[model samples]
Target: MQRETTGLLSPGTHVVEVDGLSQRYHVYGSGPVCLAVPGGPGVIWESLRTPALEEFLTMVYVEPLGTGGAQRLSSHPHGYTRERYARNLLGLLDALSLPRAYLLGHSHGGFVAQYFALRHPDRLSGLVLFGSAPVTGPEHMAEAGARVQEFVERNEGQPELPRVLAGLQAVGGATDDEQITAALRDLLPAYLAHYWAREHEFKAWRETLTCTYISGLDEDLTPDTVDDRDALPSLGVPTLVVVGRYDVICGPRWAQELNDLIPGSRLVVLENSGHLAHVEEPEQFAAAIRDFVTETSV
Candidate 1:
């Protein structure tokens, strides 16, 4: 089996050259192949690890370019657009000699997954858009701001809330790795359903979180905006849209919209989770994907 694809699926971490850059990926579990794209665009791949999901599926965790161990583009942070990321995913699939596979994208990674499904439908057996939306930019930002306000209202008197709010404020201007990592850590509490209530459970994870700073721009420094509303209706790949009820960024609204847009896409709302459903509600998250994969696999 290892010789069949040159060890791409043999387990552990593997580095494959894709488009002249080192594309690093980690493999785990042992079932139908499923590529997991981490959200950050700039966040470390480790942050998106789903140990529970790993139990049922062959999890191929992607180390997106410009972050973690993956090689950066000549354009560095500027050109790490969804299209570029989608293409890199294609390269990784081809490198692994996979004709098709299940794809699960979290947060920003969800954007890449949907775009990939639209552009290369023939290469996917199922698509899971986790904590994702159909668009980005002003409208998206507006909705996120409103959701953040709700979060603030829900936890007004909590002492840690201020720091979380500060972190949210810092996100837009963070220009380097250190700054971004700090901001992510600060804002993380707000990303959860009840951070203060369960600090002991996740404090270590927060302390160890790391990220890069990818400017959401093209090589020319123009914003790489996304609006897939029109294109989504045309997507033929079977899709599963999962979102946490408390997710401040891409909350239920966006997930519902995604479900409405994509034909035959199933939706799952993690009632007790925030942004990181896989972490907050691992069993439910894994179950949703496991069922989707089982039903969709040929």
Candidate 2:
């Protein structure tokens, strides 16, 4: 596997020019394309890469509107709402000429995926969410933020961590890049080791870190925009919600709620894993997704 200076997968960088934006994406394997959405507003398309997914489905990892190789927006304000993200995704699909495809999302990407399913049920074949929540409640939001803060404090002294965290905070709307970096340096190691396994893929991890952090800052998780609990119940599509037993970002309760709301949806909780269970245990994650897609194939 070749590495790039940008720390992204060197093999897959296809640009789809849509609405004057050069949307960068990677296509993996061959079959029904699984359009993957990454977590944060700043996160790039590469965050969704996994060895298991590459073998199972043609995964299309997409960079959000203004990050990675995607074209920058010239507007005064950047749009970070779920609706806007979903619309961009639809545009990407249109550009690719894929009338319908499977949907897979991680972290914040799952939020966009859920909204897309609700808005455009006709364009979906299946839905899969890995370690994601649907419209995080106020209580959950505070707890999540606090946990992230604590994680940052614990790992701030590492050399590489500061840069990664600083990029993350910038994406998260932190004006003070130095402060965010200092804070994030303390948190990155635990975050990667426990949640997303950033250590294993160190070469390409910075892109993932910077993108996710910035995206988190840009996100607008309001009640009006993302009401997946109500929307998911009527989705009328095959849905899979995979949660990690040790995931603090999106705890098991979040998955349980989604499972209960979405009719016939399956929820699988992976033990000994955190937020990025797919990366931590790729084989099992891939097998589960393959089985679900196979069963739902038309």
Candidate 3:
């Protein structure tokens, strides 16, 4: 089930086979093992790397199916449901000979993490939901629209704002990798609390950021919607909900609701960050994860 990994805790990329598909997971740092699932359902794993946390935790960055070098399904751009991702997570855990491990999912991956936690509570020691929400569909879209409007108001006079707006509009219609990546890079600014102010710091990340186009539909052509509010209260795993205060997609509102829904779950809001807290405020983000792991692992 596992191959090309010289050692369990060795640093670097490790390959494992799951369901006849080769899944690669990169290993970094030392301490508790934590699987870091990147967001977007198609964003490359490198974008979610947290060097700060790697100092104290063994960060296993997952190369989720349909992204990076991982094999795509016959129904690629479709059938990438949360259930499917969760199954892959389980397979990865088993392939690694890990009975349980901490999981941190960002954005869309957070949705997958929640589904995994709900279904396989015994397989996770802890859970981290970053830039995530408890549901999706029209309501979620409405909220995101409102937040985008707020972002527009805040940066009203900027010349580049129109490009960002165009990117947002293009997202819904993007049907290929190039289009999605362009749109994503165009809208990257809004993902940060302050982008133009620190463009130099994130320009490279944006330029290198790549994504595959996933239709957000199942093989049956059914929309893979989610609503976990009713079920979260029953989740028994330790949870840490991290969010960026200015995150337009999944901001404090969703994080707060998640905290409220999951009993005993902790919430951490990075005041100076938007969607990418780990990048915007590494120290604080790392500290929150370190503290949560320290406190909950006891």
Clashes of each: 0, 14, 0
* Top-lDDT structure, candidate number: 3
Model 3 ranges off by over 4 Å: 1-6
Global CA lDDT computed for model 2: 0.68
Candidate 1 wrong stretches, greater than 4 Å? 1-3
Give the alpha-carbon lDDT of every model: 0.91, 0.68, 0.92
Model 3: pairs clashing at backbone N, Cα or C within 3 Å:
none
Better of 1 and 3 by lDDT: 3
Residue 139 lDDT, candidate 1, scale 0-100: 94
Candidates 2 and 3, the one with greater lDDT: 3
lDDT of 3 by residue, 39-60 (tens): 9879999999999999988899
TM-score per candidate, chains pooled: 0.98, 0.77, 0.98
lDDT of 1 by residue, 153-175 (tens): 99989988889999999989999
For model 3, what is the C-alpha lDDT against the true structure? 0.92
Higher-ranked by TM-score: 2 or 3: 3
lDDT of 3 at 111: 98
